[model samples]
Target: MKQTSFTEDQLTDALRALKADTSDERFRLLTSEPPKARIRPLLWYGVAASVAMLIVAASIWQSSWSIHPDTTPTATTATVDENLSQLVGQSIAAQTQAQQQRTLTNDIVSEHLSLVEP
Candidate 1:
């Protein structure tokens, strides 16, 4: 004979036993505690304050900003020429300094090597 897992009667009996022993005790205990009241006044007050703040902020921003015509030259020919001359001068100075540094470094190395030999 093949041994089968829990028979239908056994399963039904176990379920019935569990149902009989279980109670709504925990649910009753939780519900017995006082329910928290919703504060509608505070919510309305916050919304009103936010709307008032936005109105004040918008008025201030509108008062501060104004549309005006451009006054000064954005890209004058003389200004561009001046900028170019300044950049060229800076580049020439940088190159001259770099060359001087290289010559000085080479001289120092040669002097040190000569001292170390014979």
Candidate 2:
């Protein structure tokens, strides 16, 4: 192999060029900027826990509203029922009166026909 030699001045100029290329302002700025903030695992866990708690609370509230226990009958309800029964009784009495009147008219007509035939 032939021996290759670099002169002292040539080696220094090459090193200077390499140093200048490596020290670019754009590369320095990119490296110097602070790193972006990252979300923590604990924060995600807390959010999940809060959502679960809210769901549980909502379910409990809904169930409590839906399941109603029977209470004592109110006076207003009793009075309404009483009025309804009275109206039904009045309707039945009116029907009975109408039926009796029809029966009386039929009897009178039959009696008149018998007298005329005899």
Candidate 3:
């Protein structure tokens, strides 16, 4: 009966003698695509939190501000008005002084230039 198992001599002969085989087809290089990222809930939560904060801030600011203030002028408002008027008067005086100084400087420069030319 022929032996079903391979002997040491048969294995050695198979290993030493090269079996004929041909693969003329060039090797095909394959690249696997990267896995798509899943949307996280944390990002949406952050956006919602920011929107909520903005809404709250806007509501607070709107509630605090008034377009039409109380018409009843108190003593403090009277003083503030007086102070504003004084500030306006002082600024006007300073502007006039600055204009006069500028005119004087220009006159001096023109006189100097005229003397240098002669």
Candidate 4:
């Protein structure tokens, strides 16, 4: 009697048997379950959206203020002048004080140098 090679029908039957195994079914079921969501990317997208919204709102608010020419609420002229004078006076005082300090420092430095040389 001659030993026979497996035919196409026999191969198909074996493949079907393998697929019908309980372990294979469980593995397939487990693998086929929906993938879990990654929290990092989702959180990043949400943060990006919030940042984008804040930027848009800021731009819109800035635009609204700039769009209407009449919306520039006028400052009282007297108050503006007074504030300006005060700031200018403060600046002048600071400059004067700085000059005085520089003069004093120069005198001290010259005195020290003369004393060292003598």
Q: Considering every candidate listed, which one attains the maximal lDDT?
A: 4
How do the residues 1-118 of candidate 3 rate in per-residue lDDT, one tens digit apiece? 4655779998788787975544443222123332332345667788999999999999977665544355333447678799899999999999999999999999999999999996
lDDT of every predicted structure (CA atoms): 0.78, 0.79, 0.75, 0.83
Off by over 4 Å in 2: 1-75
Maximum-TM-score candidate: 4
lDDT for position 92 in model 4: 100
Assess candidate 2 and give its lDDT.
0.79
Model 1 lDDT on a 0 to 1 scale: 0.78
lDDT by residue (tens digit), candidate 4, 22-47: 68778898777454546677888999
Candidate 1 local lDDT, 1-118, one digit each (tens)? 3336778997787677775323588678666745433467668889999999999998976654533234243657798899999999999999999999999999999999999999
lDDT of 3 at 1: 47
Ranking by TM-score: 4, 1, 3, 2
Runs in model 4 lying further than 4 Å from the true structure: 1-74
lDDT of 3: 0.75
Clashes of 4: 0
The lowest-lDDT stretch of 10 consecutive residues in candidate 2 is 68-77
